[model samples]
Structure formats: C-alpha cells, structure tokens
Target: MFLRKSFTAALALPALASPALAELPHDWQLGMQPAATPVMVQIEDFHRLLLYIIIGICLFVLALLIWVMVRYNHRANPVPSRTHHNTLLEVAWTLIPVIILVLIAIPSFRLLYFEAAIPKPDVTVEAIGKQWFWTYAFPKDGNFQFDSYMLQDAAAAKAHEPRLLGVDNPLYVPVNKVVEVDTTGADVIHSWSVPAFGVKMDAVPGRINHTWFKATRLGTYYGQCSQLCGANHAYMPIEVKVVTQAEYDAWLAKAKKKYAANETPDALRVAAQ
Candidate 1:
C-alpha cells in the first residue's frame, strides 16, 4: 500500500510541479537537448554557432526586403538611379557567399571527420537492425547477443517510463569508454540516431558502417530510427544505459554466464530464471 501510494505521488508531482511546462522524462528540455556525451557537447556548440549565423542572415534578409519595398517604391522615388548593375556590388555579392561557404565548410568537414574517425576503442559492439527491432552483440566482451524490443504500453505504464521510447533491453556501456559500433541490416535499410551522442549512421544490408562515441556521463539516453524503413519503423527505439566501470564489468560477467549454454542445469536454470 505504501509503495502504491509512493508511485502515485511521484506521478502526481510531475503534473503539479509545472502545470504550464511540457514535462520531459529526462533532465534535458525540448528547446535544449542533452549534452551528456562529449561528442554531443561538440555537436551542441556547432548547432548554436549555426543557429546564430542563420538568425543573423534571416534578419539581414528581412531588413533588406523591407528596405527595397519601402525605399524603392514608385511613390518614394519616382526617378530611379540610372544603373543596371554595379560591378562592386556584383563582386561583393558573389565573393561574400563564397566566403560564407568557406566559413561553414571548415566546421562541417571537421564534424564529419570527427564522426567518421574511429579512435582506439575501449569496447566494440556490432548492432544489427532487424524488422521493428534491434539486436546487439558485445563482440569484445563475450559475443553475448540480445534483441531489444519496445516495451508494451502496459509495461511502460507500470514502470512509469516514457511511452513509445522505452525498450525491454537497453544497451549498456561504461561511461568514459570509447565504444566502437558497427552497424548492419538483416532486411531493409535503417538508421540509428541518437542526438545526444551525435551519432547517426545508416544500417545498410550486406555492409557495415562504423561509428564511435565516448559517453561522459552516466544516464539513460533515448533515441530512435531517423530513417523510415518500414511500417513499424516508429516502434523501434534505442535506449543506452551508461554505468560505472565496475558496474559494467559486473554486468558483462553476469551477461556472459547468463547466455552461456555449457553450465550446470541448476546454474543454467538459475541464470535463466
């Protein structure tokens, strides 16, 4: 009765805490996403820089449009300046865009290389994208493979977890470890996207695309398929559980024993049980 009351109180608190605000399950907000990982922080910085540039450009363009409409109107200036085109203005317009492209290209290429470049990874995992599910193999640990499916609505509701974003089996990794991931598909194409990790790559059939990330914090990060592959594409969600090194090692050991087949019957039953 106490546990039930506690759970109900917890659920009620979120609603009353901030009635006007849209309550996000995690600490990250809608306007501001999580920068829990190192790569994600870099991506966030890049995003802010790009946003400033875009806003500046938009305001400038709007001002220019208004000036043209008001100052160049027939009532304002009956006699137009006898000028087809100014060479300086033409050159300025052409070269300014080129300079802007160069400015944008430097960081864009750097980010691409950062995402594509794989460093000396502390751990490696092979992620296989199946129809409406994801299968993960911790090849470096013990070749222990498992499938991750979306938690049913009833299950999520019982657990008080996020709807449509929670999973039965979440991918676990140690914080501050460079995790190398190789992605492939069993059927059609699917893209694994985690905005908080700054990682997104297409899972192509018969081929593997590689990416890596080093999580800087311990938290439950959520993501989903960025590409629409099939009818149940929205059903597949990605949950990453980052833990301490000691906890990760313990989990790996238990996972290896849990998936092993050559153990004693009682032990096997206990592990499975």
Candidate 2:
C-alpha cells in the first residue's frame, strides 16, 4: 500500500548531524528503545529483573500443575481422598505468595521513589497538554514557548520524518543535563511521556506534576501522550532533541527571538506555526 511505502521510505532516510534529529523506532521493535538516560537504564535493569522472576514463577507453577495431574488425576488415583485437610500445603501457598509480593514490592518502591525525587534541575520545561497537541515552555531559557503539532502524513513523507511522530517543533534540552518537566493539562488529563528517557508524568487539571530525565546521549527521542485525552489523542506526539550545551544556548537565543517571551500564548502559538 502507499502508506507502507511511505513508512519504508521514512525509515530508510539517513540521520542528520544535529542530535536534535536522531534515531527513531523501527518496525516490530520487540524491546525498549535504546536507553538515552541513566533513569531509563535503571528501568531496563528493573524490567529484566522482574522478567526473570516472572519466568521462574511461571515455570514453578507449571511444574506444580504437572505434578498434581500426574500424582492425583482420576486415571492415576481412582480413589479420591475423602479428607482434604492439608494445613501445611495451605500455609506453604500463602507464605510463598507473600514472599513473592515482598520481592516485587521492594524494588517497586525503590524505583517509585527514585522517579519521584526530582533532583536539582539544570533546566525546567513546562509541558501543557491540550486536546491534541503539546505546548512546551522553557522557563530557564528566557521563558520562550511553542506549540508542537504533529506533521501531516504528506509533509512527513516529503521530509522523510516518521508519520504521526514528527512534530512542527521539538522540546530541546542539553545533553547530560537534568531536565525537569512540569506537566499540566489545558483541557483533559494527559500524560507527557518519553520511553527512552523513562519519564512519564500525568498532566492533570489545575495540578502540576513533575518528572526529570538527563539525556546521556545527544539525540532526538520521540513519545506520545500516554493518556487518552480527546478524539485526536493519537495525533499528540512528543519529540525531544538532546543537544550539547552550546547548541542549546544557540537554539535558545534564536527561540527567544522567534517565540517571544512577552507574547501571549495565542500569539506565540500562531507565530511558531
């Protein structure tokens, strides 16, 4: 189909030098996107740890099921036990599940705390989630702000950008800098999330939620609104360009001029487009 060809052409395009335009997802990716931050790396480790535990538990249960069928099935044992009061077996089952829960909880709590504790941010960006778009403001960088709208499929095909993923503007941050994102919804609840950075924070009405990420590499990462907000929720994409400090400064200078700090949201949003 034409859509399939467009996708193939988009993926085949080579990457640019600027980190702002970096790696992208491919078809049928089975694992996480390459981790570009320490937080994401830790997330991957935690996931693998849980995966092993789950596999072990599943295998154990399968073995138990097989043992029960072989040892106590009607064919194997014609006489069913009249008295089925196995206190030891009941205790073992209860205790084993409790132990498993404890194992899962320890790391779960640790990861939750680590994600919640926003370290001193090198830069802070406020992401205002609207019905089907994102408005990003860099408070540390002269308060310049802009709206990021998804590129149309036609434009995306022409530019070789991923369909439904490319945006008119991208949130840019310096590489290896702790970038704190404050999220709030302009309309319905939305979630600002980037999987590679392992950052996902809800954008609730009248409430600012925070999350942080320090991009260890210079590249462009993509995400979409994790929350279902509107009819066009699928169109709300997030693109972040992680560049060097110098590149960030230069971009900021231009952005402050382009998207004036003094301008109203309506005016700035129009100008940015």
Candidate 3:
C-alpha cells in the first residue's frame, strides 16, 4: 500500500521538470512511453499496425452480425432457406486469416532479428539485481559499480529526482551510441526493463543475459523491475540518463572516483572483453 501511493506520486515528478526535458511517464497516459531508441520506434510502428488491423476486424464482424440480424429475422424471411454451408465463404475466411497472419509474421521476424543483432557497442553496462535494489557496473568505462536505491519522496524532491523512479546513482550512457547491458541476479530472478528503450532482459542467478539499446535522445528515462521477484519488487526501479559524449566523459571521471571498483581486475577485464 505504501509503495502504491508512492508510485502514484512518482507520476507527477515529470511535471516538476521542463516538459521538453523529461521523458518520464505522465498521469493518465493512454499510450506507451515515448520512443527514445531505434527498437522502440519499430515497436511503436508494429503496435500501430496491429491496432488498425484489430479495429478493421471488429468493424467487419459487427457489420456481418448486423446484416445477419436484418436478413434472417423471422419477419424478414418467413421461409428459411435450407443451406448447410458455403464452401467459398469457408475458404475465404480461412484464406483471409492466413494472409493476415503472414503479414504480421513477416515484420515480427524482422524486428526480432533487428533487436537480436546488436550493433558494435560503444559501451557496456552490467546490471545486477539484488533483493530490492539494482547495482550497475560500467565494465568498459572504469570497472566501477554502484548500488541504486529508490529515493525517498523528500530527498527526491530536493534532488530533482522523480519520486519513486529516482535513484541515488543513475546509470549513465552516451546518447546516440549503442549500449550493451548485461543482466544477472544475486538472489532471485528479476528483469531489467526500460520501456522507452524497448530493452528488457531477465537477470537470472548464475547466468548473464544481454540486451542492447541505442538512445537517440538525451534525457532521463525511468523503468522498474518487470519480473516479480519478492515483496520489494515494486521498489527496485531503473534510472538511465543519456547525455552527450562530453557530459558522459565528465560523469565517467567523477563516478570512477566516487564509486570504488567492486569487481576484481581480472573479472573487469573479462567483462570488458
């Protein structure tokens, strides 16, 4: 209950920032979050196409229902025709659905392949999910890892961080560059997900899963652990800030100093490779 209330307040955090700068979710939002990555753009396109097809199918079905009610009513046709089935109609229904499925499948496969084929990544970040928080490591940057915890309402308001979505240390990456994310869980299974980036990968124990994204826009985006892990699942949120190369370099320098190297030198080297 407390988490739910906090989440509700978190929706208003974007309002505090400039409308043009914030990419966080809005209250009463009816659509998916804005697309900041190439994968998200393709996802939006596929979603739109599906919506159109669904609406057309509903309208066609409605029309058929209306026509049957009008033409076959007791008063309209007193003597019913003894017809069992129309082979042409049956074939048309089957053939049309098959054609529609093919249309949907072609793009679906292409999009999957596009997402799976990660472009030569400019940077890589490893995300490790703990019981109720997230820890991130910039493997190629400086081998420094830091824990990210949800900010309290008071601290978040003071720091200009979104209420529940904000973290003490946000994961940073250069805008317009491909970022490969490695996910793993320390205790239980969890998922690192960001809607705007169209990237979600399960963080399973003893295994590292990979997902990649290239943020085209420079802004702060928030997402939560998608997979239900435990009682504090809702509290584990992800914050990503994409900035220019210069800004990224500055942050990298500061982060390396502030956050001590958590992984061993050999482990870091292996991860960087």
Question: Whole-model Cα lDDT per candidate?
Answer: 0.79, 0.85, 0.88
Candidate with the larger lDDT of 1 and 3: 3
Top candidate, metric TM-score: 3
Clashing pairs in 1: none
lDDT of 3 by residue, 66-154 (tens): 99999999999999999999999999999999999999999999999999998888998889899999989876677778899999899
TM-score of each: 0.84, 0.86, 0.90
Worst 10 residues of 2 by lDDT: 13-22
Candidate 2: tens digits of C-alpha lDDT, residues 215-235: 998878899999999899999
**What stretches of model 1 exceed 4 Å from their correct place?**
1-32, 261-273
- Winner on lDDT between 2 and 3 is 3
Q: Can you write out model 1's per-residue Cα lDDT over 1-273, one digit (the tens) per residue?
A: 999999999998887544312222455445555676677787888888889999998999999999999999999999998989899999999999899889988988898788778999998877778899987776557756788899999997776557888788888889999999888777899988777788888988777788889988777777887778899999999888788999989988987877654222232123222
Model 2 whole-model lDDT (C-alpha atoms): 0.85
Q: Is candidate 1 or candidate 2 better by TM-score?
A: 2
- Ranking of all predicted structures according to TM-score, beginning with the best and ending with the worst: 3, 2, 1
